[model samples]
Structure formats: structure tokens, C-alpha cells
Target: MSSDLEPHGRIGVVRLGDALDWSTAPDVRTMVSTMWDDLAGGCLVLDLAATTFCDSTGLGTLVSICTDSGERGVRLIVAAPPPGVLRMLRITGLTAFFELYDSAEDALRSARAGR
Candidate 1:
């Protein structure tokens, strides 16, 4: 729903909205992709706590972001995804691809600790 880019770091936060179907899929991708150039070498933390639903495309976008981040040597972490989205992540086995967290603060703390 909202995104916050911390200054002078590769850290960014994207708050996913409730509906992550086809309609908003492109926008979500664009929004998240834009962060790549903006915060090129930093970690990108996606906060999905507000997301109530996620379709294949939505999940695809997340995977793409993670891949893109890896290519750029920037870490992408998905945190607090809603139950449905979490289920999708588990189903897709992407739960292991991302650093799942219970909250945005925890994700950030983990990201910091890893550094």
C-alpha cells in the first residue's frame, strides 16, 4: 500500500495492498521495480502484512523482484505477508527464497544484523 526508502542505504519497504490480483499486478511490479534504480545496492524489504490476497502474477512479481535483487547483489526480503499470500509462498516453495518475518521492524533488524 505504501513504500518507504530509507536514505543513503539500499533498504526500501513496500507495503502490499489488500488486492494483489491481475488488475494491480502491473502497478505493483512497476512500483517495486522502480525501487531497484532508486536504491540500487541496498536491501529491499517488502512488507506484505496488508495484503489480503495474491494470485500467480502477484507471486511472480515477488519472485522477479527477488531475482532482480540477487542479480544486483541487493537482498530482497518479504515480511509479514498475509495468510493467503503466505500460503501461496509456501505452495510455491518461495518461503525459503525470502527471509520471512513477523513484522517490518523484525525484518529490518535482521537485515541490519546480517550486515
Candidate 2:
């Protein structure tokens, strides 16, 4: 957990740990979901630039998170993924499914504007 439940009004920013693999993916999901539910309308921005690697479990957890957000009538934004993480998302066709931002600031701005 790089950052705790850092809430900036309705938009929450969760800095995913340095590695998002099987060991950390579950916690990631829990943190984001917990924040989403707590925030109402569930606007979240996940900062992934510090993350060096993400495995299948991480990717799957992301999908699950996205689904949960949608079911709650919101979307999750992800920002600044490292090279390996970006490649995996592209290869898995998840890049199109997510709203990717160049920076956390940009993602948060968008989240706020959507309100």
C-alpha cells in the first residue's frame, strides 16, 4: 500500500504499491472498492506509475474493480503506468476498457469534471 485511503472530496486517489501482483492485487481491490463505496458516486483515480510489474491476477482484479464501479454507477480512472504494466494492459486489451491518464492530477481533474 503506497498510499492510504487518501480522499480528496468525492475523488479518492489510491497509490497502488510498487508491484501489483497476486500478493497485492487483492488489497488493491479492497482499498479501491472500500473507498468507492465510502465516497458515494465512487470517483477514484489509481496511480500506477510507481508500479513496476502487474501479473494476470492484478489485471483480473482491475477488471473486477471496474465492474464493481459500473454496478455502482461510476468509472475508475488509472494514471501513469510503468512500461511493463502498460504493455500488459495493452496486450490484454484492457487499455480500451479503462480511462488512462498521463498523471494523477489529470485523472482527478477529469473525475471532478465528470461530476
Best by TM-score: 1
- TM-scores vs. true structure, each candidate: 0.90, 0.87
- The residue-by-residue lDDT of candidate 2 on 1-115, one tens digit each, is 6544445566677888778889998788767766766666757678887888888898888888778878876668888888888888888888988889989888877887883
lDDT of candidates 1 onward, in order: 0.83, 0.78
At residue 14, candidate 1 shows an lDDT of: 89
Local accuracy of candidate 1 as per-residue lDDT tens digits, 1-115:
7888888766888888898888888887888878888776678888888888888888888888888889977888888888888888888787889878889889998776765
